[model samples]
Target: MSDLAALYSEIEQKTSTFCTTYSIACAQGCGTCCEHFMPDITASEARLVGAYLLFIKKDFSLIEKVRQSIGNQEGPCPLYRFDSPFHCSVYPARPLICRLFGACAYQGKNGFAVFRRCKYNEEKTMPEHIDFHSEVPVMQDYSYLLRSLDDQEGEVGFLPEKVASMLDQLQFLAVMLDMDDTNPDDTPNPMAS
Candidate 1:
């Protein structure tokens, strides 16, 4: 796999492990966070997600839906299909922000790390002495890692628009490759090539 893809996979695993260890989890079917908040993603993440939608899922309609939702300031994520069994259609390729949303750690004013849980997770209480900085991945640190691989400077903005922009860039790259008699689909791994 490409370095970006590998890094993304690693981040996912680390986030999952941290959440499980801290008993921080989002309630099933709870779209409150999805509806109210937009995920901040890096350009690399946007490209990966867009590639997943185009190459793996092959869901162009959903891509267009994402494009349409660019200016949508509020409501559920454009990727959230109400009728679908899964809350997030592109769950596997979801960005870091989405993966670490409910269970995250932040540095408090006193220079100590504080554990933050979803408001929906009322039943689970974090330990008083929980050390978030040591256990959980810091958002800024991960963001820097992701951005290091790409020229894109900072948070790529809201997820939908970022995905749309990445998809457009990917399509352009594909066209450029096609002109040279290279079929992007025929390759065993687009990311590796």
Candidate 2:
């Protein structure tokens, strides 16, 4: 398998394990975190999402929606269809950042802090809430694994964008998947990458 494919598999596996352990009810219709800015994902993530869309034969329409969703709002995500709150048009193909929510971490005094909940989650209670932050595994470790696949020389900041931009840059199917990983500058991007 390609490096991109391996990264996707690892991410999916880790995300599934984390969600299951937390009993996270992230089924269709739950657009809580989706409302926020789309997370900045690595080029490999974009490739996987694009591939999944191609696998389902929904690339065109989904990309179109992503394109339209750009610059719409910082609140409700464009991929979220308000009329039908039960499905994400690109659920399986959603970006790695989207998959990382609630299970990922933020740097802190201690190595990294697990993002245990979201605004919606704090207001709502569920049986699965078992204080996983104190014990459960996290997505950060998997992120380390992805970095191992490539040097990823420096710190890459976050930038939310329509899925179209990701797909366009991915160029996975035919365009060619190329990356510039030698640069080691840790500069923060003023806008979303």
Candidate 3:
């Protein structure tokens, strides 16, 4: 696996550990966060997700739908399958923001880190003496890692440029593998009700 892929795996492990330790439970089938927010991601992170799509041979039409949805300010995440059952289609390759969305720590006004519990995880209680600074993966640290790897300007929103770049990268990989670009009109949209 590439360095970026390894880092992503590490991130997944850490976040999973954090959530498990904290008993943070996101409400199943409730995609309020995914519907309301588009995650910020770095170029390297984008590349990883793109690579995964290519590896899975995801339909170009579905990818195009996601690309189009990326620009929709009011729409849910393109990767989120909202119709049959709301879930991330690319959950394994989701960005850091998505992985750590509900279970993270933020620096407080006093420059100390504190646990930022998800509003949806009402049943979980944060421990008083938990070490937020060391336990939780800091966003800045991951951002720095991605910047070092890709050296591209990080994107802060679900912008077209970022999605386009990811698509281009995924297409490039597909081309390298000599994969046929079949007509994707028959591919069903996951967001369609």
Model 2 C-alpha lDDT versus the unseen true structure: 0.52
Model 3, position 125, has a per-residue lDDT of: 50
C-alpha positional error of residue 108 in candidate 2 after TM-score superposition, expressed in Å: 4.8
80-108: candidate 1 lDDT, tens digit per residue: 87785577888988877776665556667
Considering every candidate listed, which one attains the maximal lDDT?
A: 1
Give the Cα-based TM-score of candidate 1 against the true structure: 0.76
Give the higher-lDDT candidate: 1 or 3: 1
Clashes of each: 0, 2, 0
- Which residue runs does candidate 1 get wrong by more than 4 Å? 122-133, 175-193
Judging by lDDT, tell me the better candidate of 2 and 3: 3
C-alpha TM-scores of all predictions: 0.76, 0.59, 0.74
Model 3 local distance difference test score: 0.63
- Minimum summed lDDT over a 10-residue window in model 1 is located at 179-188
lDDT of 2 by residue, 1-193 (tens): 2774666667677667766765565444566666655555565555555555544544456556666666654645555566677645566656555666665444444664445455566545433333334644455665666656643542232323524555555434232322222111333333324
**Residues 66-123 of candidate 3: C-alpha lDDT, one tens digit per residue:** 6776557754777777775647777777877776666656656666656665665555
